[model samples]
Target: MPDLFHPQMMGYLESLVPQRHEVMLEMEARAREIGFPIIGIAGGQFLYQIARMMKATRIFELGSGYGYSTAWFARAVRENGGGVVHHVVWDEKLSSQAKDYLGRLGYSDIVQFHVAEAVETLKATEERFDLIFNDIDKVGYPASIPVIKERLRPGGVLLVDNMFLHGSIFDPANTSEAVQAIRTTTKLLTQDPQFISSLIPIRDGIMLSYYVP
Candidate 1:
């Protein structure tokens, strides 16, 4: 991923936050060593703050890679009346690993891991969510907009990662499917009256949409 902030700025920003748990530190190291795309400290902290601000109870994650981002949401949910976080992922091995890490973090009981396609899982579920986090395949972004909007309760939040598509979104000639999907989905959220959206430039980028209806 490109550098979203200068090194000095990031150092200063990181200095302001409290230290993370030992399990989180391990996850961060593992992600770096394995070339995994776990949401880093900035993104995790942003999601944690947003979830807490919304007082999110029932949270759903479209894609959870080793439960790094899910951990942040799990903590917030635990502090806010103790609700559940349903994390959907495709790989069974990754799910198992995430379960173990979350268990170490004392969030195993609050997080339910589903090994399946995220959209399919969302379709099969009857429950609604107070907050929905999207980090699924970029191709699914366009298809996921309506589903996310539908699943989120009124005044709920729909937070998406990788809005910048690694900086390819700004190129008019970059007509790759992933970039196009992100563009279409972002347009859908930005133009829709039911949502108020903002794309914060941190890490790859974060698209936060608040459901008003």
Candidate 2:
């Protein structure tokens, strides 16, 4: 997938990023080997920064592939003394792999990994979170807005990945469901009085929506 920044710009930004943990390095290698779509260093670092800034105690991740992004949040929560991250994935095998990865990162105790439909899992829980990270299937983005808004605590954060979807959202002619859903969701976020939203043009782009209640 094409990155949002130019090659040189991305390289320069990447150079400024601090070195990662050995486990993170290994995870990156694994993702590369599996051709997985991880948020990578830029996005992961940003997530950590946001979580730390908010002093986030409880977080919920809509779609956790192998716990890469979850690792970043988990680490942030640990540094803040204590917290829990609820991660949902549809595949049991993937959930198991995610557990192993979090275990390697020593975040297994801090993260709750669930293998189930993302929306259903959220609906079943009575938890309110300090942060909601949405990286689910793009076609379902719009559907998650009201649900997440309801569950997010006042002044909490909502971070949505793949907002650019390989730059598909910019092409007005593309009427694909994924593109339309994301566009509509973005519009809703921007138009909603409760959310202060902005598009972070980072890796694949991410939408940062802050809930004001």
Candidate 3:
């Protein structure tokens, strides 16, 4: 499979995003340094836009890494008259790092940190969310769908990252567990009667699904 995005095009898209907070910039740098995969500038901006457009007050993020995407959601939640954004990741060290970064960003009140398996944590949570963002390990994507659907309120939105798997999804020969899971998850979302879905070709690909039921 070829690259889904040209280098220059991705750079242009990133450049269009307005300046982020210093903490966010630092987090981006850290991701780059550590080869950590936080959603890039364009993806983060898009997430913020979706949350703002929907006026999503309550957001739950699966696989929040050092709170980069969580910051974006927390910002929108704060602007939408203050709400909560749950940040869940299995790594305690990453969760601690996220807490420090979000605390510095002054989103400590709006963001809740959790160190546990993201899907289980979301399933255990009692409050229905207005928006749910999933960026967990691709192999887990299919299994996570049922829980995500149950957790989201009617008319809520689900934003899923890495839908393209860097264009491997288009290659018939590529049938790894992660790729297969992505395909199955895509099928589940797009073919389901309860949701209207579109795959947006952002940095990687983000599936934006609106739940109608």
Report every candidate's CA lDDT. 0.90, 0.90, 0.94
TM-score versus the correct structure, for each prediction:
0.95, 0.95, 0.96
Model 1 stretches astray by more than 4 angstroms: 1-7
Give the TM-score comparing model 3 with the true structure, all chains together.
0.96
Top of the candidates by TM-score? 3
lDDT of 1 by residue, 1-213 (tens): 987567577456656768999999999899889989987887889899999998998999999988999999999999897989998899999899999999999998899889999988887889889999999999989998888777889999999999998889989999999999999989998999999999988778899999996
Model 3: lDDT to the true structure = 0.94
Per-residue lDDT tens digits of candidate 2, residues 1-213? Answer: 986457687567667779988888888899889899999788999999999999998999999998899999999999988889998999998899888888988998899988899977887789899999999999899998889988999999999999989988889899999999988998999999999999998788889999996
Least lDDT summed over 10 consecutive residues: which range in candidate 1? Answer: 7-16
Q: After superposition, how far is residue 83 of candidate 2 from its true place, in Å?
A: 1.1
Clashing pairs in 1: none
Q: Indicate the residue-level lDDT of 49 in model 1.
A: 97
